[model samples]
Target: MKYCLSFLLVSLFTSCKYFDVEKTTSEAILKEELKTFNWNDVDTYPSFSICDSLISKSEKKECFQNNLSSHILKFLQDEVIVVTQDIHDTINLQFKVSEKGDLTLLEAKVDSLTVKEIPNIYELINNSLNTLPTIYAAIKHDQYVKTEFELPMVIKVE
Candidate 1:
């Protein structure tokens, strides 16, 4: 009787289902995330000239735009995985670049994305931007150079 009782107790305990650890919401993931930039050691491109005398302000702005686009594209290519069929659709990201060229990630709104999804979407963009290599450029004497930049992104569900 004792042996049977012990076996029964052991089996009961062993067969019981343990509560699962709750999965974190996308917001939580976004809030606490830190992305790292991984530039290819051998194939890294040279930094562009920031102080070219011949380059006009418009040209310098174009350079900045191109640099930012390339950085974002490389990130999406390497780290992101698109899960949706309509992943090719573009999402406009409205943000500001400080005089120091630091990005302040702001509100992200899309027709396809629900209000709840906005936080996650913004987080993803922020992570991608954080991982991009820095562009060290001397902005010509324009006090508080705040520029708005829009970049197209293809979202992956994964």
Candidate 2:
């Protein structure tokens, strides 16, 4: 009878060490992930071939934006736009970068004056993107994602 009790006590004390491991709940794990999650941010912005060589995130973004702006500006400058009135305004050009890196013009917000002077300004800007080199979609968690961008273009003509 004494031997049985000793065996039971030793077994119970030895089992306590196995139960010492801390248990994690699913809700706690989910909460932890949420705490570290980025709500509306991407790991990497959509990249262009010209901008791809950049190592820094801000540099890549700047290069992407500048390259796009330069392309549109060059296209606009090449066209001889004759206006009777001295026009100075900004155009908010909105576009979407698809999962396949296709740039689609969503909208062009231009004042009535600018539209009247350059009726085909939207078409011209859209065409500039069409001529762009290959672009890669944005990356988030190692997956490609679509993104939207709005570029404010200032038009100052004498």
Candidate 3:
């Protein structure tokens, strides 16, 4: 009986290596995850339903840009933009995509001359952005994240 009890005890405590000496805390796990993540880049860019079919990152980005540009152009096509002289300028449009997949127009960099030529240019651009379809927020470290984008539009009128 003594030998059997000793054997059982020895077997129960056989390997100390199998026991975890240090418990893993949430802080440690969070730090380890942060170390593996790249803060400067997102895992996935904001996308539209039409662009979601794309697989490659470059293809997804191109699809997003093309869809955005075409939507704005289509909206503009319905309106009439008249200029007295040839106006050549680039409008820098800044946008923000929220983690919840909401698109907001942050700013529209239009020159004084362009504003003068097209008084309601800002309004037109803002309206077009507001009318855009649902956008999926960007992804980083397996979590939804907000992203900023700047798209330059060239205006050339004869």
Candidate that scores best on lDDT: 3
* Candidate no. 3 TM-score: 0.78
lDDT of each: 0.55, 0.86, 0.86
Write candidate 2's Cα lDDT for 52-137 as tens digits. 77898889878887888788888888888888898899888887888899888899999999889888887888878778888889
User: Which 10 successive residues of model 2 have the least lDDT summed?
Assistant: 39-48
Give candidate 2 regions above 4 Å deviation. 1-35
Clashes of 1: 2
Candidate 2: what lDDT? 0.86
Candidate 3: tens digits of C-alpha lDDT, residues 83-120: 88778888888988999999888998989998998899
lDDT of 1: 0.55
lDDT of model 1, residue 86: 37
Off by over 4 Å in 3: 1-24
Local lDDT at 157 for model 2: 73
